[model samples]
Target: MSDWKTLFHKDQFRFIDHTNSIEPVTALDAFAVDDALALSVEKGASPTTMRIWTHDQTVVLGIPDARLPFIKEGVSWLNQQGYQAVVRNSGGLAVVLDKGVMNITLLFADGNKIGIHEGYQMMVGFIQELFADYTDQIKAFEVKGSYCPGDYDLSIDGKKFAGISQRRVKNGVAVQIYLSIEADNQARAKLIESFYKLGLQGEKSKFAYPTVEPNTMEALATLLNKPLTIDFVKNRIREKLTDLTKELQQNDLTAIEKEMYQKRKQQMIVRNKKALGDLFHE
Candidate 1:
């Protein structure tokens, strides 16, 4: 059990609470953060940041998702449900994001001492401490039926509530996770399963997508038998981070960050255009 203090250390985490708005930093916001932090680390302008963001009714697809045999059909299905679809610049498959879902990205600069497991463990440890009051027996294991299933999927008992993905750029690593603190997890799962069906249309393609099983998906509320919300999870993060370190500075995108963000935003636009072609052709 690594201590939270050791993981975050005594540095200032450029934090942002999305519960309050400022230019609407969506999940794609981190595509910029990743680039900015990677540069900041190279120039030594700032310390690591733990940015928190939340998006409502958005379908974040993975690169593989964009390559789905019938991606146009799948994306169209999502749009019909009033869910905006965008392929992220990170790994992993399709994931459902909503107000009830909160995303946490820990931007860190490792001078080569931190390995992959170490960075991931820090988050796992933080979640354990955050939800300490709920259950102490949480485990990090791959949940097969999970949408973005990974080895470090956060689970209590047998159901998953969160999944983490890592992207390393230069010396900085942005570890991002989408936690379903609250919401109808089964409904979310069903959405992606439908997406796979529509995206593939039973057509044999070179790419393979997960056959999502809704039964394997469960929200933190269902796992803990308590009504939960993103606010609850945000509060948990604040308490843990604040308690671990003497200073807690929750911040928004600074001028420097904004400058860098704009560039990455354009990059995202180009990437999206490639990933999601004009559905008008559909």
Candidate 2:
């Protein structure tokens, strides 16, 4: 694994924690926030930033997922099961996000010079270091039967606990990850499995959806055999950031970023409407 410090060495790191905010911020807002942060970092208005966010019941889908044969029915099923579905502006298949799932995004400048694989490696290295005390068995490889399977899937003992995705805006890159810290991961996998089943309806499509096996996914609390909570993981992240950089400062969105967020959020709204059509709702 690449040393995280070598990849992300900086004098200061800005931290934004929205995990326990009283204000309601949906997954749509979360993605928009990342876009605004990316632009800010790219323009040198913001430093390297580490943001933590979580949402309630939401299924974030990829562009191709919206094209599934019976997508309307699939989305209806998700709604029936008390989950709202939205297509994200990033690259990846459908992923389940709930209160139990903690999302972390690292945004920094110089995206033009960073190779795609290096962006992924930076996240992998950071995750490994975060849990180094518990175990050194975290490995990054494609977990074939898991939702949003990718080359940067974080797993232990053959069971995946997290997945990573990347989004680049102008000269900045945001490496995003969803960690199944403490929840029924099997149930989460099963939810996606049923979604695909309904969406495909036994019909063939160019995109090959994974044959999701619920047993292939496990939560970090279960995999580590420790009672882990979102708060615990957040603290670990803060400690790691402090150790990696000379200073860690808590910052809020500036006026420019807030304005950018509104524009990005509107784009997200329009994108979802076009992608989901009648199925899209606030």
Candidate 3:
């Protein structure tokens, strides 16, 4: 585990908590925000940032997912199920997002300085700190049957509760994680399972999708056997980061960042349009 103290040895840390905001910030917008903040940090105009955001009933898909055999049918199924699906600009497969799930993006100044696993270890260490009181058994290993399965999947015992992925823009890196704070994790997993079933339809493909098992994934509330809400987890993040930094202040985007965000967001929209084909306009 990389030491948070060593990785983030700054005097000040910028905080942006969008947990309770009523603004129309989509998951697409969140990626743009990270990109803009990352570039600002790379230019030495902004401090390393900790951003918390959540989207209501959205399924964030990866690039490969859009290439599934019958992705259009899968996407239509998602729409019929009342979930808005969008492809993320980051590396990962499909992940569920809702009020019950909390996303944390730790933006640092440079990507080249850190190895990929080191970036993941930073988040793993931070999460271990967050749940220090509850348990120390949180493990990081690939959970094979879990959605977005990766080596950095944070688990307790055998069930996965969170997964980490990293994205780099220019010299900046955003280490992002989606923590399943509450609700039925199996329900979320089942959605993805069905998506692959419809999309793949037993057809042969170059890429192999996971044979999702809902039991392999769980929420913090279920895994920890405690009432863990998104608000509660947000507080834990703030408390832990506050203890490590000399100063932690909430900061919004600057005018330049906002402009950059608009451009990135448009790019995302265009990418989605291209990737989803007819599904994009719908």
Candidate 4:
């Protein structure tokens, strides 16, 4: 209800689903792509865009996370667990990425009209609408002891299943959410807990990292008692867009966006190198 109508009542909604990409789309690439789309919207080259993406077996770290005292050991441990590590181009601590997690980005050109909390609230409303049929009990609040905890973490009955973060480029804003569709949320939390344990080593850091508890998180399938799949959620997102907007169409990146994507992708690479040193540089 907090200005969500202004955020979502667009004449055109461009839908892009990258959930089935055959190529290895790392979390870094996903960030770059979102920035590209956001800039495209800002420049009036694209309409409001909704993108769905997924990555397999990756751990996305925040900039603060890269500065952890024992980061190399933590990254090595993630590698041993068959998870690739990369720092994201935004805020928040470490978060898990796997096949069962679906990431959604809603990009809109707001031209400084939207505040940061407004963007987060818009995503909260959109997600509640997305799953309104199942239950109207979704709540947005900081789920303490959960990975990437924030004031806008989305949860059901006190257990978090999703987290929202926002990034802005020029006049455009990208509101991103990661929904644990159907997988081992506790196992994912355990991995993050170990990562933090190795990275922090009980040091008193400037930033207060989360003390992840496996019980603080739950997958949507478990939370809703419904067999939810990424594919199913992807379709539902498309359907919801169609129902909410004047027009909804599956879209590919324009030439301008593609060019911007390449530049932003390079920027992401450089950022990762600076934050991660030789571990990210190829």
Candidate 5:
């Protein structure tokens, strides 16, 4: 195992479930919620929360993704395909987000001793362990034809089912990742590949993106050879949460967190526009 972040070993194990809810939210709000929950954990007000959120027909792009030569054309293509496009202040390139995807945001406070790789390693370990009963062949490798391919992309036999990204704020870290739990993986890949073609426009760019091949990506159901649903993944997460901690709580946002969510939500609106404008500068 890699050197996992030690700053959060003592934090409580927590879980929050928003199962099958359609939330048309920004990544900024997600980051803010992560920060607040992490602070709450640091203060011992709550357990280390595992938050799950879902969005429908939205395209979340990375910062570098915004700089594509023909981003406007790419975005226009997405809108025509009925997908909302927004920029996420995080790593990775373009990814198609929708109702069928399950996003898990793990919030915790890592003390001074934590490094970036260690933080990511912790989540990687958790996912592998959670699915240990099913199989141990889940490896971290860049899925060449998958949308949002990364070093931590989780796949079964080279077909990616999930991608992980991280954000750090004030000693609190939000290791966020999205699992294509259930969806039309082919359609999702085609959408992103089109976006890349339109955005890149056969022009040279500083950052090299994957030449996406839609056939190479798949859903958890198809990969697992079973009728896997979001409910199954949710339950699996709950099962893992129970085993990792002594106590698990089912709860809602606190007063402070509510206020922060609203404030940071407005910031999200600004971020979305700023990101688009930066990419599609007139």
Candidate 6:
């Protein structure tokens, strides 16, 4: 495992907290924000950044998910369940995001220097450090039957509590992870299972969809058996970041980043429309 300090050691680090933004921000906007931040970091307009964000009921799908045989029906089903469906511009299968899920994005420059596995290891290492006080049992390995299953899935014992994915924009990389902080992890997994069932309808597709088993997933609070809140987790992230960097600065997007955000957001709107067709709506 690569030492997280290798990736995190910096003179200055920017921390952006969008977990409770004054204005409403959806998962779609969150993806765009990450893209903007990636561009800013690549351009040296910003330092290494750690962004904490959360979204309400939403199911973010990967490009291949949009190709499900009965995707239109699957998306409609998600909407009926009060969960908005949107296709993400990143790599991954369908993932459930809600108030209880906390997302962290580590954006940094010179992504070309890092291999895909290395990038993922950085996130795995950082997450392990974040909860080091709670448990040293966090393992990074694919949790079969979990949504968005990956080799870098963060888990305790055997149940998965988090999944990491990466998106590289030019020379910048945004390594993102969604942590099931405090929620019904099984419920979220079951939702994805049903979505796949409806989308596939037992039909075969070129892409292999996951066989989701609700029991294979869990939340961090449950795994740790602790009364963990999102705020509590956020404080831990701040403390760990402060200890890793010389200076920690909290601020909003810059003017250039705002401009890039609008452009990236428009691209996302177009992508979602193309994927969801008539089902797509603002």
Tens-digit lDDT string for candidate 3 (1-282): 257666656788888898887643788888888888888888888888889999988999999999999999999999899999888899999999998999999988767777777878888888898898999999999998999999999999889989998998888989999999897999999999999999999999999788899999999898889998988888888888888888887878889988988898899899899889778742
Go through the candidates in order and give each one's C-alpha lDDT.
Answer: 0.78, 0.91, 0.88, 0.89, 0.75, 0.92
For 29-54, candidate 2 gives per-residue lDDT tens digits of 88999999999999989889999999
Every model's TM-score: 0.92, 0.97, 0.97, 0.97, 0.89, 0.98
* TM-score, prediction 3: 0.97
Better of 1 and 2 by lDDT: 2
Off by over 4 Å in 6: none
**Candidate 1 wrong stretches, greater than 4 Å:** 1-4, 280-282
Question: Which model, 2 or 4, shows the larger lDDT?
Answer: 2
- The candidate, 4 or 5, that scores higher on TM-score is 4
Clash pairs (backbone) in predicted model 3: none
lDDT of 4 by residue, 11-77 (tens): 7778998899752268888899999999999988898888999999999899999999999999989
Q: Please report how far candidate 3 places residue 49 from its true position, in Å.
A: 0.6
**Residues 1-282 of candidate 1: C-alpha lDDT, one tens digit per residue:** 245457566556556676656555665665666667656654566666777778778888888888887788888889899888887887888999998888887777763667878778878887888889889978999988878888999988778889988777777777888888886889999999999989888888776678799888888988998888777778878877777765677767668867887888788877888889894221
- lDDT for model 5, on a 0 to 1 scale? 0.75
Weakest 10 consecutive residues of candidate 2 by summed lDDT: 1-10
Query: Candidate 5, 196: how far from true, in Å?
Result: 0.5
As a whole number from 0 to 100, the lDDT of residue 169 in candidate 2 is 93
Query: Least lDDT summed over 10 consecutive residues: which range in candidate 6?
Result: 1-10
